[model samples]
Target: MSDKPYQDKAVIVTGASSGIGRALALRLADQGAWITLAARDAARLAVLAEECRQRGGKAIAVPTGVTGEAQCKALIERAVAEFGRLDVLINNAGIGATGLLEELPDLTLFKRVMDVNFYGVVYCTYYAVKHLKQTQGRIVNISSLGGKSPLPYNSNYNASKYAVHGFSDSVRMELAQAGVSVTLICPYWVVTEFHERLMDKDGTPRGPQGRAIYSEKTMTADQCAATTLKAAARRKREVLMGPGWLTVWLRIIAPGLVDKITIEMVLKPLVRRAEKTQSKE
Candidate 1:
């Protein structure tokens, strides 16, 4: 790519406390970008900020909840104040849960996930668009495999990601004339705290699905982050990485066949495990 684009640019990464977000922030910082780290966990954000600063780039922590438009705007404002202008905004703050839709004890978490995953993206983009237009900047949204293809146990997460995928695509078209690039990074099963945070209806950590998926093939957060930065530098409209990319085309070409494989490979085994656990209980 044409001589590293991040140097001396202002980039904001939500969910910067850990995982792909943190990896991206550090990677960008190493390239001399002034990094704004945004996340709900203030302490972890602070730690990451220091780490970024030590990496030979400027860094700051903005404790933000993307669910609120005001906070999202504030995040941009802080970035501009610190770095003079914003070049990239990564909408990556999100969370999810695991349970069958029929078994979920409360629907509130569904809304929570949507508010954070989809609406959070909308809020950040709504505020970032103006500055991006001026800088002719890029907006990258961290979507998921779930966005393109729904997963077995994560109905709420699938909906939220699908919304993100839809929203990012529509805006990418609208903002083209304005010279702002919108890129969506869709990956499957990276190593992250995502699974540990996902809860069952009973408030307990969910079962082995995440682990099972990882056991098959999981990308490291740093690897995903590097791919994202590389894609963003080229201003690619969309980047789909990992084995999950195959499933998307399979779903399009032979949906019934894909569904049958999903049933046998993923759904049935997980369902049997659940049944066994319930019987023991």
Candidate 2:
């Protein structure tokens, strides 16, 4: 394997506006990759594309909302047209929601989460598979620990990730013979804007205290991105970061204990914080 695996390779990173996706794109830029930055925020993507160019990679900013199939198709088409071939597809676009399932005002919240987190992945992969097979390239699906172990008050988010988990695994099997590799990345609590963007029962962003509690724990986005790239380079089928594996193990060996910990240590703190924030409001 080359020291710079991404050198000259054409890679597409969804959710390139910020968080893990942004971090990963910058790192790939450092490796001299030809990068296609995809996200809804055109301004952010443009800025990131310039940064990638400064870091020694060729980059193009494509403002894309991955939830739509036509948009996803266009993203792939544009990347191939620019770079001539597709080497990697990072399905890093995702959204989050909080609140117990029953507390949610309507099931549309679930649909909204699923559309971005799950269907976005499906649509991108559907279009990218043929190109990936042509290059014997890779597909990296960004998932979460919640996908493996149910997290309290995050049913919508969990369900979407769970679907991603299943989809990635099934696609890996289907594409194995085609020389297309699928890697699923599950990370627990990375310090990202994800928490701040997490929606509440009414589809509004959750309070600051909820975001703060998560930032207090876990690794940074850069750390997660570095680990992710290493895993992708090795074509790892699945990689769990931070306390992700421990949480999954505990869930298997001591399901009840895991449940208690999730409720007491994780869920209750957020609930208390939310209540405290609401009291002041």
lDDT of candidate 1 at residue 64, scale 0 to 100:
95
Each model's Cα RMSD: 1.9, 1.7
**Every model's TM-score:** 0.94, 0.94
Q: What is the lDDT of residue 44 in candidate 2?
A: 94
The lDDT of model 1 is 0.88
Q: What is candidate 2's TM-score against the reference?
A: 0.94
Q: State the lDDT at 107 in candidate 1.
A: 84
Candidate 2, residues 1-281, lDDT tens digits: the string is 78899999999999999999999999999999999999999999999999999999999999999999999999999999999999999999999988878777789989999999999999999999999999999999999888888888888999999999999999999999988899999998888888888888889986565466564557889999999998999999998877777888888899998888779998899789778978999
Candidate 1 C-alpha lDDT tens digits along 1-281: 55667999899999999889999999998998899999999999998899888988899999999999999999999899888898999999888877778887778877888999999999999988888898999999999988987778788899999999999999999999988999999988888877767776554765556555466357889999999998888889888877666889889999998888888988888788878988999
The TM-score measured for candidate 1 stands at 0.94
